[model samples]
Target chain A: MIADYGYVGLFLVFGIIFVAGALAVSWFLRPRAPSPEKNSCYECGEVIKGGSWIQFNVRYYLIALIFVVFDVEILFLIPWAVIFRELGFVAFVEMVVFIGVLIAGLVYAWKKGALEWQ
Target chain B: MIIPVLTLIIMLIVGAVVLGFIAVSAMFLIWWERKVSAHIQTRYGPMRVGWHGALQSVADVIKLLLKENITPSGVDRLSWWLAPFFAVVPVVMVFVCIPFGNIFGIELIARDLNIGILYIMALTSICVLGIFMAGWGSNNKYSLLGGMRSAAQIVSYEIPLVLAMVTAVMFAGSLSMQKIVEAQKGLWFVFQPNMAIAFAIFIIAGTAEVNRTPFDIPEAESELVAGFHTEYSGMKFAMFFLGEYTNMFVISALAATLFLGGWSGPFLPPVIWFLIKTYGLVTFMMWIRWTLPRVRVDQLMGFAWKVLTPVSFANLIVAGWILMK
Candidate 1:
């Protein structure tokens, strides 16, 4: 098991190396001519307006918040699901209850308009 | 000392093989997708490059590598420079857990971690961060919108994706990819009625997870000018392209392993079976990408949160109840 994790670490290192190596090779071969117009931010060929740091839609943030709640619920569900057969009827019922509560929460969120895009 | 040195050498070779596989697989998928999309539109895609444009992706890679590396002014140097690496590396890391079946009596996976599915899910989630970074770092309005949309879409669909996967885990009773495959040796999970729904949910949410059409609003070409990657050029853009196709492969491979029975078939080799199922799913995704129109952002979010999420949850409960009984 420990050695298996070692391979994972090795792969992580390998992944970084692969990306870095590709970039390095490209750098050595690629051109570096940077003109003012070329380096400016893209705005569909029009003159650059103000910066792109304006306020974003709150719906994105709202969706993320709801996702976090359901994601956490999923984190709990995975372990229970793996051991469901062994744990028998009681654990199954318990998980069903847990999931039911979360579903209610989802429904509540829906009714509250958290899921609506507009 | 001898053992440690031997292990180091083995690790090095495995790393190189995996790296080569990632590069080659991404290139092949890109070429395959072009051919698929072109045929759907009644046109020859890139017949000039090689026999039926087989070498088109290779030429494209060479061109991208040789092009100018443009760093737009007022961009965040750290995030901008690091975004491509961030995009490519996590997808690369996912190869560590993929079970490619045994060949010549040798198991071909890198490491079949006990938490294989969990590990993959976590790594894929991290991909959103890289995309968001690219959007923010570029200082381009379209990029930011693309990044934000990508983030929101991935997170929303992930609920159904995970729930659907959990249904499979429930049936398999193990999180390891190899164990899951072993459990399906007798009868693949997709054949069961409830598991069929689980499989459908997995595929649907998975298509969304990878940002393919009609869920590809994040990088909608017409709307966002390539979305979060609009400002990327040269090798950086190539990295993003590689990451996208590699992500598609990972999703397809996972679907194959969980539902279609990974590497288990009659007569032919296990690796061949695995590739056939995975590439079949990939081709399906490409076909859908070309055939369907992109959805409105509101419609996309509402569909994930409203329809897919609830159906998956109901399916999970029904599956759990049936299994318990």
Candidate 2:
């Protein structure tokens, strides 16, 4: 297991280096031309107005919060799913109940209108 | 203690090979998608570069290389500089565990980690961070909106995606990619009713995860300019392209392995079988991309949270009940 992870680590290191190396090579070959207009953030050819960073919708955060709850729930289910067959009916029942609790949460989220996009 | 010299050398060789494969595969898929989309629309795609624009991607790469690398004013320097690397590197790292069948009795995978599927899920999830960074770093309104949309979209769809994979893992009784394939030797999982649902869910959620069309509201050009990558130019933009197409490949390959019986076939070599299945699914994705219109963001989120999640969870529970009995 340790050695398996070692290969993954090796790949991770190599991948970062490879991307960085490509960028460095491009830096040497590419031109260095710049102007204020060229450097401005893209806004479909209109004079830049207010700051681009504005307070956005809270719905994005709400959706993110709901996602976290379910994502964590799914993560917990994975290990159980891997060895599920071996554990048989009793374990299956246990998981059904576990999932039932989560379903309740989902239903509550639904009823509360947390899932609504508006 | 000393590093194993032969193993290190072998790994370096493998890394170089995989890197080459990623570059070539991305280029080919880009060309193929254009052709597929064009032919669907009843027009010829690129035909100038090489025999029907076969070398178009190569020329494009060169053009990008020679172009200036622009760092827009008022951008977050650190994240802006690193976003491309973040986008490309994690996707590249996922090539580590992908089983490419065998050649001459040697397994083509870099290392068959026991937690193969889990590892892939983890790595691919990191891709969202890169897009988010690019958007935030660019200090552009469209990029920010695109980034936020993607983060929300990917996270929402991931539940169904994971649920589908978990169903496969339950059947296989292992998380290793090779083991999952081996479990399907007698019959492909797609042949089963519940597994078929799982397969459908996987493909749908996988498409959304990669931010493809129909589910591609994140980069919906009609609304968000170029989306999270609006400020990206030249090679940095190319890296995002590489990451997107490569991601399409990875998701298709995973679908092939988990649902389609992987490289297993009687008449052909395993590698040939694997590529055929993977690319077939990829073509199916492209066909869908060109055929369907992009979904509205509210509908996209509603579909994931309301429709896919509930249906997939119910499928998983039902599949488990069948397995236990």
lDDT of 1: 0.92
TM-scores of the candidates are: 0.99, 0.98
Q: What docking tier does model 1 reach?
A: high
Candidate 2 structure quality by residue, lDDT tens digits, B253-279 = 999999999999788989999999999
Highest DockQ against the true fold, candidate: 1
| Least well predicted 10-residue stretch by lDDT in candidate 1 chain B | B316-325
Which pairs clash in the backbone of model 2?
none
Residue-level lDDT tens digits of model 1 in A2-106: 778898889889888888988899999998889999999999899899999889988778888889999999999999999888899999889888888988988
Q: Across residues B1-325, which tens digit of lDDT does each residue of candidate 1 receive?
A: 9998998899889889989999999999999998988899999898999899999999999999899989999998899988998899999889998999989998999888999999998999999999999999999999999999999999999999998899999999999999999999999999998889989989888999889999999999998999999999989999999999999999999999999898898898999999999999999999889999999989999999889998998898889889987
Chain B TM-score by candidate, in order shown: 0.99, 0.98
Whole-model Cα lDDT per candidate? 0.92, 0.91
